[model samples]
Target: MSALDRSAATPARVWLIWVALVVALAVPIAAAAASPLLAWRGPVYIAAGFAGIAALALQLVQPLLAGGHLPGLSAYRGRRLHRWVGALLVLAVVIHVAGLWITSPPDVVDALLFRSPTPFSNWGVIAMAAVFAVALLALLRRRLRIGPRLWRIVHMTLALVIVLGSIVHAVLIEGTMETMSKVALCALVFVATAKVVADLKGRAKRSASP
Candidate 1:
């Protein structure tokens, strides 16, 4: 195939990917927005719950950007976006927790302390901590003078914890998110993370060889 032929298809592919991702991200939010549960909840509580959903949606996007799977984004731009999205993910968690705290300080305290009765609360808190850890690592990665292997290991370890914890946390809750959409989002996050992690592992292995 000529370069022109291959180049002609790239824009179309990029557009399709962007549209599919946007729809995937929007589905759960639409489902949650339609839920009857929100009718009785206060604004803060509703905002907090939706923030969690937003964060979950972010999980799928992060890995795609991190892996450079987004066709139109240059590597430099992709890395930059990954950083910004990572920051947003952290912000979303803060909003989720803060709004919940506003709604019920005691419950938030219990969850933070790992004393919450619900299994999902434990997972949520674990994921929240992992989110903060990843953010901190990113912030201090250069200052800490960590070795490349160690940094990747720590980052990947925390990434796995965040993904798995968030999955469990979302799955265990019965909330505004519709069942089908919630499950589908979780599945997409899992696949995207797995693909990126596997690719990273292979690259690491190849780099280690002569």
Candidate 2:
């Protein structure tokens, strides 16, 4: 195709991808909202569950932003948004656990202590720890003067933990999240994380080649 034709096609393709991503992220949340589960839970519990859901949705966006895959966003802007969204993710997790604690102190305590009867609780706690570690390390990055390579390794490793642990935690629980929607969300989260990791690795390999 001619350069003009290719140029014209590019924006349309980007817009289509953006719309698809927005729709994919929206469907699961909409399904959860329409579920009977939301009505069954009290406000605090509902808030907690939705907080977790919001975090999961943010997870889908985080990697895309970090990888500069979202059209029209410069890499700098994307990374800036990624940092802000990371902070928000941490806050969502805090609200999720705190709300659950208020609703059932014993359960929250057990989960934190890794003694919860529910397997999902253990995974949630693991993910929570990984989130906290990531935030803490980010804050200390400059102070610690971490080498770029080391920082990327640490960040990506924790990211993997966050993605996997969060997915397992969300999937194992028979709670506020509707099953089909929850599954769909988890799948998308995995895909997003995998794509970013793959892209990052490929870039690293290219850079390393003589």
Against the hidden true structure, what lDDT does model 1 obtain? 0.93
In terms of lDDT, which candidate is strongest?
1
User: Residue pairs in steric clash, candidate 1?
Assistant: none
Q: In order, what lDDT does every prediction score?
A: 0.93, 0.88
Q: Which ten residues in a row have the lowest lDDT in candidate 1?
A: 1-10
Which tens-of-lDDT digit does each residue in 93-134 have in candidate 2?
Answer: 999999999999999999999999899999889999999999
Name the Cα RMSD for model 1.
2.7
lDDT of 1 by residue, 103-209 (tens): 99999999999999999999999999999999999999999998889998999889989999999999999999999999999999999999999999999999999
**TM-score, cand. 1:** 0.95
Backbone clashes, candidate 2: 0
Q: Give candidate 2 regions above 4 Å deviation.
A: 1-9
